[model samples]
Target chain A: MRATYMFGAGDVRVIDVPDPVIERPTDAIVRIVRACVCGSDLHPYHGLPATAEGIPMGHEFVGVVEETGRDVATLKKGDLVIAPFAWSDGTCDFCREGLHTSCRHGGFWGRNGIGGGQAEAVRVPLADGTLVKVPVGEDSALLASLLTLSDVYGTGYHAAVKAGVNERTTVTVIGDGAVGLMAVLSAKQLGAERIILMGRHQARTDLGREFGATDVVAERGEAGIAAVRELTGGDGTHTVLEAVGHMPAYRQAIGVVRPGGVISRVGVPQYEEAPIGFGSLFGPNVTLTGGPAPVRAYIEPLLPRVLDGSVNPGRVFDREVGLEQTPEAYKAMDAREALKVLVRP
Target chain B: MRATYMFGAGDVRVIDVPDPVIERPTDAIVRIVRACVCGSDLHPYHGLPATAEGIPMGHEFVGVVEETGRDVATLKKGDLVIAPFAWSDGTCDFCREGLHTSCRHGGFWGRNGIGGGQAEAVRVPLADGTLVKVPVGEDSALLASLLTLSDVYGTGYHAAVKAGVNERTTVTVIGDGAVGLMAVLSAKQLGAERIILMGRHQARTDLGREFGATDVVAERGEAGIAAVRELTGGDGTHTVLEAVGHMPAYRQAIGVVRPGGVISRVGVPQYEEAPIGFGSLFGPNVTLTGGPAPVRAYIEPLLPRVLDGSVNPGRVFDREVGLEQTPEAYKAMDAREALKVLVRP
Candidate 1:
């Protein structure tokens, strides 16, 4: 089978690899239908400590169950499904508390030892808990939505919810990536009265506006915060969704949120130590929440909305290609030429 | 009137000063009954930025209203009361959101233009919103509780509540100061099943145990995190209250909390920047909430408990002195000679 492997930073390639068979009683094998380049994947591409040689690439995917282990339940061969980036045992205390991303036995799909989704076929362990089955015969356009539910959509929704987005909230979404766009959608769905998307790209900014972004700020750094404050009647937004995981972006998100408001960050921190202003956090009474997304917990609540066409997150997939072209797709994504590039096996 | 002032780091003196009079329509003058040294007060004592002035000292005090301005309606002359550290209008959006500590027009006492409580008489602005009236003719012993209600007790309660303490929660409280000790009591009152007080003094630890602390860990750093984990069946506590405002204490609190659990920080951050691991924060799905002690909001709910004998946090006060000894009290608190020192003016 052909799979994507990273030899070094910016060295992702599609290569022939041995097929995966059930290595654990809970493992299941799936033939991927659609997958995409994720914002988190860019971290390793840009050279973080988590990136390594011979590492499998990609964590978001929608696929069909090709085989299942004897112990797996609630899923069968040929079921169309979406799997979250992190695989959990489903019974750990954190998982039981609906925080699967922090499950005691959970692990990321691509970073450490697991094979990822930017490939033709992949082995998924703990399939019954990690994969959500989509209703059969859904349109292919739903593939984009399913792919998003795997990570970006669930993550963006988690960010919005953590930021306490409600009918009275005025939100500032600090990114133009797929997750940020989806956060704008999530904010709108969560009944935020207004959403300001801070981004610099025309294409992604337009996508953000279409996804319920009521305002846009193309500036960065202090200027970005100034723009948000200017739009929020000079009090700052009531909620800020931080989707870019970097020091500057984090600072911007924290800066533009109103006193007693929140900064919900879904950005995968690219560095081990992100500098935070404790005085600002405590003095302003800000609430900070985010971590690996509890995607498993959000899928059930979000599936009906996605299936019923209440959200059109598929618009984020500006480009689509076959699995064989994933290397070029990675390049395009790295260059910021594509909002999100979908690949089908 | 005489008030305690800081001339420099470690330099405090009881000096004769002009008596305060009503300066605003919402102001009220109070004859301070009891004032106590706070951990935050030591921040300026240890010489941080803005620490080089003859600033009046003290914010936590229980007092009798000596006079009221024309617009002061909720409080009256001769009424006993506990004033929140932060003054708010009580009608702003932040106050209505139960975040009076972060009210738009909020101002702190005992810093800059605000007068301190360690004096014969002090002026309180936003008197109607910031001062909670205690029952008239309350005994002097109630002064201990009333004094605590002004800051430490309320701050501890704020930390516990923000940490989401409840019957099912296993709480770990960092710091053994008056606020941390009160947090042990607060967690117990909130029905926490297991309470661990991290402290070094056997006397204070005994008091904490009496206040419902099921365990005590004198060790700091990794050892402390290990002790908490061992107590929680290797899962760590569900709620952690951080009362010590320092880098090590903050890190320790974060290290010991369980995934999906809450860390409520009442420790005022003295540093402009705090180092946090964003990867670990988001990956573990932890929730952080904190800020200044919202004493005004909690006074109503907790006062009844204090008055009815359902809760008594006054046991934390280990020493009492006349206002003339305010300088010695600060020195004793600085040297950890007293768990908490209550001053009678």
Candidate 2:
């Protein structure tokens, strides 16, 4: 089997590797059918001193059960499934509360002896608790959309839900990447009346409009806030979806959320500390929420929409690559040459 | 007119001051009938170099309107009323959303050229919006409870409501001061099934139990968190009411809130920044909300409870003083000799 390994900053290679096999009674070996390079993956690829050594790389994948351990009962050989960005033992208190990212017995792939999903074959632990089976023989576009359910799309849904998006909500989705675009779609699905997409990219903004953005603010910083204020009648938005983790993104969310409104931040925060004193939140009474999404919990609810062909989030994949081209996929995304890349194993 | 002034840290003095008079078309002059030394008032009494010059002090008071400007239609001479911690125009977008603290034309007492409430007379701007009229005749106890509506009790109610407390919720209220005890009462009124009061003072905790605290954790720091976890079967409480602005109180609230739970902080925030990174809130999906209570907004809803004898938040006051002894009231509260003190002007 061929597997993608990131050795260091700006380094990615697809090399022939031993096939994955079940190592525990609750494990299963999955043959990867579809995978993708996530925006967060760029963090390590661009350079992470803590991750100096080469390691197995992906967390999002759609696959088929090649084999299951003796204890696996819910799934069988040849079953199609999708794994969330992180695996969780679904029976824990956190998982029961729909917070799988905080599961007691599960952690992220690419580390902690767990196998990455960006390979021809990989081992999945806690098989019954982690994997969600999908319908067999889906079209390529639908497959790409289903692949997003593993992480990005579900994450956007989580942000919109946390921000309290609904028919009466007027929202502003920060950022214009794949996740941000998906947030506009999710907010629309949740019945938001107006969605302001704050992005500088013309192509992405056009796509955002297609995804249900009622307005677009291309300015950055205070000017961006002024633009949103102009759109919201100078009162600010009812919900601010913070899909970018940068300080400026958060600043925009805080600035534009109306008094008593909310800011749901879901971009894997980059700042270690944030000012949440009287001036930032208290005076206006803003609710701040969001984190790594419980993709496992969202997958079931969003599957019906993807199946019905009502939402085509896969339109975000502007480029596609084979397993051998994984390294170049990273470069294309890093250089902003591709919106997002769909990879085939 | 007599007014209480804080000359410096631990220095409170009562002195003669000119009586307040209406100066604006929307202004009304009110004679103080009742005022209290709030827990937060101690912030300035115990040293606010910024407030170094002795100024009339007090932001919590119930009064009788003695005079009204030509434009003041809602309030008139000899009307009984209560003022929130801050005054707003009541017509701003923020005021319309029940976030009066952020009102564009409003500001807190004793700052921004506004007159403080703890004096023989007070000049209230935006009288129609700032004052909530009370029934002509009520017992001192009811009046005291209504006084709490101006700040303390309303603040606790804000904390509980923002934390989303309800019949199905379990709550943990940090601090055992007047506000914390009131939070216990507010949570009970909100139908919280279980409420934990965290405080080291047995007397305060005893009052908390009377106010509806189902459990009490006398620990602090990590041990406090462990105790709460143990109480909730190692899962933590569903809602945390942060009524104390101290670092440890905020930390305990953040540490004990269950995944997908909320931390509503109504304490006058003392910290400028908080860590909301991956390790703090991003992974578990916690929501944070709350600030200065929109006391004016809550007054109408909570007044009926006080009127029908369903709640007696005035029990938080353990001492009584006259205008001449207002300085002693501050000393008593600051020394912890009294939980709270009420002053009659």
Name the candidate that leads on TM-score.
1
lDDT of 2 at A65: 91
A127-191 in candidate 2: lDDT tens per residue? 89999998856344588989999998999999999898999989999999888999999999999
List candidate 2 segments past 4 Å from native: A50-53, A138-140, B50-53, B136-139
Question: Tens digit of lDDT per residue, candidate 1, span B140-253?
Answer: 557787778889998999999887899998999998998899899999989997999999888989999999999999999999889888888887788889988788887887
What digit string (tens of lDDT, one per residue) describes model 2 on residues B64-165? 889999999998888899999999999987799888988889988877666677788889989999999988553455888899999998899999999899
DockQ each candidate and list the results: 0.68, 0.77
Interface RMSD of each: 2.2, 1.2
Sort candidate 2 into its docking category.
Answer: medium
TM per model?
0.96, 0.95
- Native contacts conserved, per model: 0.80, 0.81
Task: Give me the displacement of residue A46 in model 1, in angstroms.
Answer: 1.4
Candidate 1 interface RMSD after superposing interface residues: 2.2
lDDT of 1 by residue, A1-345 (tens): 998887777888898888978888798899888889998888778784544457888889888888999999988998999989888888877788898987778788765557989988889988888888989543466788878988999899999988789999999999999999999999999998799999999899998988899899999999988988888888898888989988888889777989878888898766666544455677777888887788988889999988888887888999988888888888899999888999887
Model 1 chain A worst lDDT window (10 residues) = A271-280
Question: Could you tell me the lDDT of residue A229 within candidate 1?
Answer: 89
